[model samples]
Target: MSRNIEIEFKNIVTEEEFQLLLRTFHISKKQFFSQKNHYFDTKDFALKKLGSALRIREKQEQYELTLKKPADIGLLEINDVINQTEANMLMNHSVFPSGEVKDELHKMKFPIDEFFLYGTLQTDRAETEYKNGLLVFDHSFYLGKEDFELEYETIDRDKGEQFFNELLEKLNIKIRYADNKISRLFKVIQGKKES
Candidate 1:
């Protein structure tokens, strides 16, 4: 299994400051990538607001599966739909979803009420940090309603472990043991209340 280091904060930076900090961190706009927009004329299954979804994400020659549920957002239950799409990148290293891969998977056109964008920072590994309600994957980050974000991740297990240790030393965040089980950021967000 791949290893990862994740950190979440209360978003201490303003939108402008956050954008500046990303640049200071040497992040660039070119790294951002978007999935092909598709409208599904017919869905195999009618997606529900409170149901679970199994998602398989393919990125940078790697693949990961994630199981996710809807967030506490009201309305048409778009959070779960967005979560399933976001879970692929979060489960794999923080690389953006491959347009080609998304295209290959979406065989038929479907109605899309919303669109999602993601980016990655690759350095032997990746780190996805969530701050100020924005999911910053590596260098490129995006903000949207009902969307999910991931913090740092490493494809190399050893490097990931090192990053995790470093983060623990530097920040007062909690680390969850990474197991080959279903996982998602919403779970962490919801679980943080007890910790």
Candidate 2:
């Protein structure tokens, strides 16, 4: 597994603002790609209570298992590349790939047997470099719900925040309180189940 520190500034956007941002940045459909994210958690949201998340992402026929935990800057992400066969097993049979992720889970005191696939999210995304950071545009759908988001990822948190805040103001976009995609998707799934 490979580890990386993710420092990102994220905000929700309306459809009108989404389209405006795309046009403002000159992004096209050709520059975008799609991915399906399968999220896993315990029935009681054990992982969520601990401020952690697990998901297997499918993009271009490749699968990557990612675990995110709270970190000082943003979140610490650990990723493992697995085959389609393993991914299918995870979705169909609730089997997680055996590797650092599993080992780390055990180390973190999470009962491996409790986690299971809970929901899925599909996203159409476009990304580009902006102000020394990677600017990402995402339109995601899950559980009959859809949302648009703008994100900027960079190593320097201070600079990233400054640039991100100013960019929103410059674009005439209102600031929004945004949760991470997985958390938001899980909430939507939970809401659907409750209703």
In model 2, the clashing pairs are none
- Which segments of candidate 2 are over 4 A away from where they belong? none
What Cα-based lDDT does every candidate model obtain? Answer: 0.33, 0.92
Model 1: runs farther than 4 Å from truth?
1-24, 36-148, 151-158, 168-195
Tell me the tens digit of each residue's lDDT in model 2 across 1-195: 799999999999999999999999999999999999999988899989989899999999999999999998789999999999998888888787898888889899887777888889999999999988899999999888999999999999999999999999998999999998889988887787799
RMSD (Cα, Å) for all candidates, in order, is: 13.9, 1.0
State the lDDT of candidate 1 residue by residue for 3-121, as single tens digits.
12222221222334445544544656565543322111112332222243334443454344332333443111111223345554433333334343234224323223222222221
Candidate with top TM-score is 2
Q: In model 1, what are the clashing residue pairs, if there are any?
A: 39-109, 39-110, 39-111, 40-109, 40-110, 40-111, 41-110, 127-152, 128-151, 128-152
Error of 1 at 116 (Å): 21
